[model samples]
Target: MRTKNFVLILLSSLSVLTFLDRNAISIAGHRITEELHLSESQFGWILTAFTLSYGLLEIPMGLWGDRSGEKRIITRIVATWSLLTALTGLATGFVSLFATRFIFGAGEAGAYPNTAIAIRKWFPLQERAKAQAFVWMASRLGGALAPLLIVPLQMQFGWRVTFFVLGGVGLAWVLVWHRLYPSESPLQDNTDQQQYVAPENDAPRWTVHLKDRNFWFLLVMYYCYACGVFFFISWLPKYLQAGRMIAEKDLSYSAALPFLLAAGGCLLGGWLSDHLVSRIGLNWGRKLVPVVGLSLSALLMLGCVAVDSNVAAVIMLALGLATMDVTAPVSWAIAIELAGKASGAVTGAMNTAGLLGGTIASLGVGYLISWTGSYDVPLIILAIQLLIGAFFASQLKVSTPRALDKT
Candidate 1:
């Protein structure tokens, strides 16, 4: 394979590693809560701790990656998070676990922004959405695999040992990444000149993005999208086993199905976005896929709430998640399209908003369930949030250079 493609594959693997680490906690949620003697709300706070720190640290990490180089930043990220993931297994109570998860979130904060920067530096604009698709698909694959993998390990070795094992997997990836990933582009002077390697421009400041209206819209849209998606990653497993009373034997398969379905959604979203851009022009191409996808996602989520059978409900939830994910790559592409050279900073800002949404959703769902005695209310709220995201997506100005100024 070409070196650039090789780099893409490695970076994509990092994406998978990230989701595996992040989702592992949720996959082992039942065991953790039982061991710690924690209430549902307290467990929710544990998840929130991670997301809050992840959101708050995103911009700094993104800026650092942009200035210092993603290779070094990514190296630090993997090492820190891996160590923290191991420490997570050592937590004795709520405070210790929350602190560990918060720091772990900080460690993992800049991963995707750095990945976006790497994509911006390495791939052509036309191919970026598809590249992002592969990265997200890998993440979904990791998420899909997490329940299937973690549950069996937890059943065999206990949850603490299962976490220790997951931590080791990341450390191994770090060794390969440090050795193989080149900081500079391998295909710099090739025929892919359309892939603008954003020139260094110290003149225009990063604050320019703050004043851009479209940037805020993108941020809001991403925030809403993340709220809906976060519910699945942070709460789905427990929601299946607890809220819906799914059998433990069925929990792993049920939890994994949505993400597995979402893997296909990412590929479809990427292909559709690229195809539409070529045939109908960027205006409709970029906006249409997300608009349609998120809208359908909203409808499907509502279906999840309305269904009677646990099996039918899980299937609806899986379809809803897949539909929502169809917009994931497109959203990242919009960030890259709007930010240009500062893809890291802009995408980081957008992700910050998104994770903030995730933080809120994580905390809220716990209380929402505790208060209401069911998942129905929270699911309805998330469905409404997806609709709001679709509205923002429809308003995006992707075709014009007017969305961003040339630095």
Candidate 2:
């Protein structure tokens, strides 16, 4: 493989690893609840712990990536997070588990921004969206692979072993990454061919980026979208089992179907965005990909809420998630574009905002379902949020092209 593409694949594998670690808890949720003697609230907290820290640390980690080499930043990320994942296996109670998950989130927080930075360094502008999409799709594939592989592993060896096994994979990835990756430059010949790697400009500090209305718009957009997507990830299997009357054994197959579809959607999203940009222009392409995806998914989500049968509901969900994926790459690519060289800080902040919404959805949606006696209410609420998110996404200006400018 070419050095550029090889790096992309390695980075994509890191995307896979992060999701594998993130979703491992969901796969083990049932057993963990039983063993901990926990309520639904506590189960929600288990998920929340990871997201809260992960979201909170996103900007800092991202800034770290932009300033430092992605090689060292990613190495640190994989090592620390892999250790946290292993520690999660050994947790004795709620506090221990929550702490480990939070630390795990902190450790893993830098992965995406670092991946974004790496793509910026390696890929030409023409392929960036497709590149982002491949990484996102790989992550989804990891999510899809989790239930299929981890659940069965949990059955055979126990949940703890499942976690340890996954952690081992991350550790192995770190060693391979450290050995194989070259120190690639972030810029090429920009002005009159005078070029070498320069230090990242300090202009995109948190305070400055946070103050921008456009930044906040993207933040809100991601948050609303994350809420619904996470609601499904955290609760979908239970919904399938409880509301849809899908059998316990069948839940695995049914639950995985949407994620598999989600992987396909992610691939389609990146390709479509690139195509749209090439055919029309960047601004319209970026805006329409997400706007269309979210709007289409919103309608599907409303239908999902109203549908009665398991078969039909699952179909609607599959379509909804696939449509949602279409905008996934744009959400990421634009963050870096807008932030310029400080893509790390902006991307992290943007992701952190989304995770805040997701964390709330994970906990609140659970309680809402408990009180309301159905997943329908929370989903209707989420569908509305998706539309709001779509509105925000539609307002983006790809013509700005801040990424191309000197800071």
Candidate 3:
């Protein structure tokens, strides 16, 4: 239990570093834009570069995690993304920065899917949601904490040096992850007695997974969700400076408000989902939380557009993000459970689709802003996607074996 908890902490820390490194660009977006002599649309293209690559590669990397050991793949991914992030410091032009960031996104594409596979490997059914929540919260916490850390660092060092330092931190984590993770699954460990008692299998093939209807539905839900999230990740800083006319100092902490709230939602959702599942059973556990979460999320999203002040807008955004996060753990939890021994592969596919959604949302929102010259217009579009997400999540059919319901 202690070691598993340690592993969780490490996973969470890495996620924090990932968000910190990525979001650092947002914190420095104003300066970067001026330094590079960039047009607003060109800046959008910079983010699109990363989003496009990240979305395209999520599934392939996730599948690799499923087939190759999660520990190994995750460690390598951390190393790879960190290296690319560091290279971002060396970029002198929009094209150079875009390429580096895009490559960084590709390396990061499988992080959550791999984390899902790790949870499936290490945690029991009863604890999976909490474990996933821990994972999700850590990532959010990283984002929340970024302004505190990265903003100060960027101020002290130039923004470029900040990226280099953040990248170095990731390299350190890779060493630790590689050291801690065992070569084989913990279930297969001779020291442990818990047998997952593997589900009955019929000569495993990728085709069996590819044919499932539930899988596609989940994919659709994730894609929609990703669109909303990517919008936040890509546009929040600009939104603060442009949309709200916030000062850089306030922008640092205020930008984090939504993420801080989201951290709580991530934990709350995970803990609640697991408890509900344990009490009710898989069908109810799997379906109930997501339906309610996505529905409420849609309402809150629409609320985000209605707010007049930056304070109100971000607070509403926080609530909207929290409501959506309420189902996040369950989403990944279902993917791993349904995947069984193939957790990595299925999770990867779901994430891949989500990334595509993120890519579309990122680019689409930018174009909306460019065309309409108002953040609210693009945000309205995002709200509509959330509505669709709610519908998809409500109708989702998660396939878990009846016998495993109590597990």
Candidate 4:
């Protein structure tokens, strides 16, 4: 096979491992809480620790990838996080678990942003969104797989052992990646000339993005969107058990359903966005999916809450997550378009905003559950956030950068 295709496969594998390790904690959350004697609010703090450190380190890690190279940085990230993932199995209590996950987040912070940089380097403009879709689709595949794998493994061997196995899986991926990934970026002979690749001296300064109104709009849009999407990652298993009253035996399938549909949504969104870009142009093409998808998802979230039947609620919740995910690949594509040569830094900033939103959702859900004693309110609030994101996505004014003009 071609070298770029091989790179894409490796990158997609990394995406899968990233989410598998991430979702394992939530899948085993109930077991962990029971074993460790933790409260709802305390568990939220554990989740928050990861996101806070992850957000804090995202830009710095992305900048490292930008200045140095993604291959070296990504290798380090996976190795550190994988070791931390193993150490999580050894946590004695809340404090130890919190510290381990926080450092793990810092280790894993720049993963996708660096993957974005790799995509920018290896794929052409037209293919980038589809490439991003495949990567994200792999992540959802991991999410879907996590509950199926973790529930059984934890049931048999225990939660701690499940983490150790996952950590080993990540280390295995790192070794393969180090061995097979090209030392330099693959030739981009077929890449779009209209795409900007600024020289070392001419690269856009970080301050330039600060002045771009569209950049701020993108940040706000992603922040709101993350608040909604993170529910699947951080709380879905607990919600399935406590809120919907799903049995432990049924939890894996129920939780897996949403991510399976989300994988399809990523593909549909990427294909639709690319088709629209060909027909309408960049601004409207990129704008429409996020606006429509998020708006529809907000309504589905409300429907999930209003429905009386547990089955109906699960279906609605699954569809809501799937619809919201339809915006994921398109959003990354827009970040690349706006980034000039700073794909790593720009995507990093966007994801940092997302991690902040995820942090809020993780913490807020725990505290709100304690206060109100219902998960429904948090779902409603998240729906509102999605609506807010759709509004910002509508207002975004996207244009091809002037730097691309000369090419």
In the range 224-307, model 4's lDDT, one tens digit per residue, is 989987888999999999888899899989999999999988888888898898899888988899999999999999999899
Alpha carbon lDDT at 282, candidate 1: 79
Number of colliding residue pairs in each model: 0, 0, 0, 0
Tens digits of lDDT, candidate 3, 1-407: 77677778877887788788778777777878888898777887888888788767777877788677788888888999999988998989988988898898888888887887777667776778888888888778887887778777777877888888888999998998898865655554333454543342322444476666777778888888878777767778888888888887787788888789888988988888878777887767776776777677777777777877777778888888887777778888887767776676677788778778877776777778788888888777777787777777777666553323321
Query: How high is each candidate's TM-score?
Result: 0.96, 0.92, 0.93, 0.95
- Residue 156's C-alpha lDDT in candidate 3? 80
Which stretches of candidate 1 lie above 4 Å from their native place? 186-204, 399-407
Give the per-residue lDDT digits (tens) of candidate 1, residues 318-377.
899888998899999888777766777888999999999999999999999999898899
Best by lDDT: 4
Off by over 4 Å in 3: 189-204, 401-407
lDDT of 2 by residue, 1-407 (tens): 28878887998888888878887887677778788887777878888888899888888889888788789999999999999998899988899998999899888887898888887776656677898999988888887777788777887888899889888999999999999998854353243333423223333444566556777889899998898788766777667766677765665667777778988888898888889888998778777888989999999999987877788899999889888877778888777667656777788888888899989998887788778887789889999999999999987666433333334
**Clashing residue pairs for model 2:** none
By descending lDDT, how would the candidates be arranged?
4, 1, 2, 3
Question: What's the CA RMSD of model 1 in angstroms?
Answer: 2.1
> Which 10 successive residues of model 1 have the least lDDT summed?
194-203
In terms of lDDT, the poorest run of 10 residues in model 2 is: 191-200
How far is 45's C-alpha from truth in model 1 (Å)? 0.5
The global Cα lDDT (0 to 1) of model 1 is 0.88
